[model samples]
Target: MRKERKMDVDDEQVQVMDLEAQQKKTSESDLPKIQKKAKHPVILKFKDVVYKVKFPSQRKKFFKQTTSSPVRERVILNSISGVVYPGEMLAMLGPSGSGKTTLLTALGGRLGGNLKGSITYDGKPFSNQMKRNTGFVTQDDVLHAHLTVTETLVYTALLRLPNTFTKEQKIGVAEEVIIQMGLTRCKNSIIGGPLLRGVSGGERKRVSIAQEMLIDPSLLFLDEPTSGLDSTTAQRIVSVLWELAQGGRTVVMTIHQPSSRLFYMFHKVLLLSEGNSLYFGSGSHVMDYFESVGYVPSVPMNPADFLLDLANGVSPDESEDIVTVKEKLIVAYKNNIANELKADLREEENEEADHRKEANTEIEKWPTTWWQQYTVLLKRGLRERKHESFNILKIAQVLIVAFIVGLLWWQSKITHLQDQVGLLYFSTGFWGFFPLFDAIFAFPPERMVLAKERSSGMYRLSSYFFARMVSDLPVELILPTVYVIITYFMGGLKRNAASFLYYLFSLLLSIMVSQGLGLALGALVMDLKAATTLGSVLMLTFLLAGGFYVQNIPAFIKWIKYLSILNYNFKLLLGSQFKPGDTYPCDGDTKVCLVEDFPSVRSVGIRGQFVSAIVLVIMFVGYRLIAYFALTRIGVTRKSRTTKSWLLCLD
Candidate 1:
């Protein structure tokens, strides 16, 4: 029996080994196919690229009279040139004032200046195809702070991956990217900001990189990926980047001073100073180039540190003037390296013309359908903002305000017509301002995120706008509904179910109108302080013309009352609470009723209530349309003045 058991165990072990060997053989066979699929690598080539900004003429004060000087042109990048091939990482190293970022932006097709010269991907001009295949990581981490790492990437993948990919496939892609970027441990961690506690700096940076990698971009550009990390963490980040380059990505990053270990990881380095290229070559041969140019450092030092020192106009030989050293380096680069780069670029360009002809025929479309974008964006918006919308403090604020208002006017008599009218007006005005301020913050904080996503062509502007409005509607209306329920009963308004719903409906419509205006103002200004100030002034004007505060506004200014959302809201509220011919008790021996004749009540007559509602609905839609138009004009979409003007006329 023992012998038979031993034979069975040996057979099982042999079977397991055979299975392992087959699996290994399968993986090895698949490796070349994967590599071949990714072998259509993008090569970035730039030649004589120059960026300049024109400063307006300065006004001079002479004898108390102002005279303008001629406009001056400041060169941000002065004829910079370089090439980055696939499977290579290029680092742009410089001091504070150098044009490393400017050149990087130019190559990324994001620079907004008088940029001259050629920048091509795979010897083709920048096109939508190139844009789709390129990924850019900005310096500042522009992720939502409340979302978990996995949530962030998953939403990005859903919105960004092609519509051909199923939802499960997109999710699987996000998970694969997370694992590839080594973020599995912090996949569930929140990306925190100044006031929140969550992931570390290294994790946040990794999340940013992972976000770009979700699309498997062939070309990647990063602006200072290691800005604030410690040496070890920075090295780890660079190591990940090295692996990405090894996968046939052309990676270019503007780096601040890097540690020696980090420096060696880069395959190529471009050193710049004052908008001029100092050196551009293989990272390991930089010292050799400098030594050949007769500027070798006397002592061994970190290559990055030594390069930065030279770029900053510091000389290895103490006797050389800084200005002279800079001129010499620039001259040496122009004389020795520029011609060779140009010749290579010309040869490559000749070889790529046929390839470009074939590639140019391909058409690009949005990755997701409109409905798909809306659904994914809606889900993401709900998850990201649920915390802010339903936080304890915000809930408490609404409850406290409701309780206070309810107690202040608790169970007033029907005869108290003035008190009832005051309550109705207060409800209109409170909702008017409550949602305005809340909605004003919507677009300003999100401007960066919106710009980033739009640049990447993740979804349509209309889809995003509609999804944002739809997601905000429920969250924005809940508090006001609660406020009405508390104050309506305690304040002794009409107790009928229809009347209650009407009151609720009127206040909610008012909130929607005000929220639309807030969105418009926020999108228009896009500056928090400025938008808030403008909103305060606009709301105050509306309040004064709302018929309760100034019943008989001046004729020239009376037109504003029609424009005031609160005016229509106040009228609707009055119509909802009081019916025609309603009366209240009067102070007299005969008890003559005068509620119907009250000036404030008569001004906001109970009739034509539906007209007020129709107008409110129009304004609600109009304000949102204006906000959308403003966003399109301000880079949210391709600007079309004809479309904007036609829409405004229709509105």
Candidate 2:
């Protein structure tokens, strides 16, 4: 009887185990399924993968090993290949710092750092047909808040969409995307990020999706689409992505910590650990493989979580299988695909070669020209800044400053030599340049916006640079005009009304010179804090170094005075104040001087005007070019093509 009871218990145990197995099989059968055909495969890729930079932390080490700072690069994917076919979604899910964003950026071919791998957009690298149909959404939402959702999309369509798309066609496309993303209710909402208040996080995420889809890209790459959202919202976001995939565009994204509902939406999952490709296959297989290797998901943990745990070596207990399971996946992937090696960096050399070869290729078949890009970007930039409250305050501040400056240096026939020198200094440097500084600082935030847009293909750099110059004309004239009217009326150095007007014109010219300098500065620096500090330092050096506060530096540094913006403004404008009979007996300081001994204006030399204007204009152009180059390099940084770009690579 005891033997029969033991046999019966054992039989019951086997029966219970078999019943649980059968239920799991039945449950899996009920889940939504994806076939291999639904999963996208790599079609085209960059041939020689090269990264001119690493993350900031890695740069110093890279330099230490390489003896060159920024040039120290790594080949991420030599003749590195990847593909994206139509009608499938390939999710490049990876651990943090596995170059997911870098890869996505490289594929976009817009504003990426140096890259060597030949990314075959549509059969060939940078094929006109492929570029026209591809869109990339970065981790950050790059949208103009001032423009409502509909307007932003409309503007994008106007700028990027083919001429075949009419106003009605554009609106139709925009409306479809709006409803598809569940933005029908807040269709006019602002896709706001930090410091902005508009649509909720979930809606904003979808808006980013809509913006990319509006262009009808053949392949879309999104980095961290579901970051910083709740499980339900994450699931909803992924579902939209899945639905988008159903429409036939190859969608790829880096997803982190997805819920179970979210996990199953992916057609294929590429698991990465420590920059190593661990698995590149199905999501269910992701869990099944782990289970087969001796790990099981506890009651409610999502598969994504369990996969990460295995990869990170999170043991369930003393006798647990997490370590062994993770190793099994890594080994299995490595064995199957056989891709475990350091990537060689070679983009720079290849780019130089490609530039030489493509030099005659008459800028790929694009709907717009570089000039058009600039114009649109410039118009948008103007819109961004023209609406800023700071600009209005600037007008008020200019009037107050002009009034105070006029009162302090009230035009006097009692012309002391120091008074003349002081007037020249104040007008050339302060009145002219301080407003420039204010105009620039006021526009810095807008510049931040421009950098984001320009980095993408929203507009051209030259357009933003030139448009700012044109837009600032009114802002530039405000203080100089006010000062000119006030000072001319005050009758400080009046030869005649004509002389006053001439001086006013010279002052306006001086202000313009300063304006150019400020715009250049706003574009050159990466961070606002750094740019602001540098601007302060530059302005101070220009003032003190321009023979304003101090007489002059030693003969060795007198050349610095020539570079000073104020020096030029002072000379040109002061020449106007010199009356006809003015001749100076030099105190051996010069062979002949116009104001050194003249009674009307006894200290400011007149010819300084001609020399200063020439120098200031030249310096203005020079500074503007520097600004452009800096902005371009920054765009490349965002794309992680530059070794310096790695600094921004986040975990």
Q: Per-model C-alpha lDDT, please? A: 0.82, 0.61
- Off by more than 4 A, model 2: 1-85, 107-126, 166-172, 191-193, 318-327, 336-365, 414-421, 432-436, 439-458, 491-497, 583-595, 598-604, 637-642, 648-651
- Give the per-residue lDDT digits (tens) of candidate 1, residues 1-651: 445535544654564466445434533442111231233589999988976666556676767975566767677678888899999999999987687777776688765446788888877877767777888998888899999999999999998888778999999999988877767888999998999998999889989998988888999999899999998688667767766787788999999899766776788999989889988888867876887787766665777888988987888766788899899999999888988887777755556677678667755558888999999899999988888888899889989989998998999876777788888888888888889998899999898898788877888899999999999987688888888899999998889999999999888999999999999999999998999999999998998888887767789878998899988999889888777777777774347565557777776567789899999999999999999988875443323233322222110
How good is model 2 by TM-score?
Answer: 0.77
Question: What does the lDDT come to for candidate 2?
Answer: 0.61
Residue-pair clashes, model 2 = 30
Worst 10 residues of 1 by lDDT: 642-651
In lDDT terms, which candidate is top? 1
- Candidate 1 runs further than 4 Å off: 1-39, 60-70, 347-356, 587-596, 633-651
All candidates: CA RMSD (Å):
10.9, 8.6
TM-score per model over all chains: 0.88, 0.77
Cα lDDT, model 1, residue 200: 96
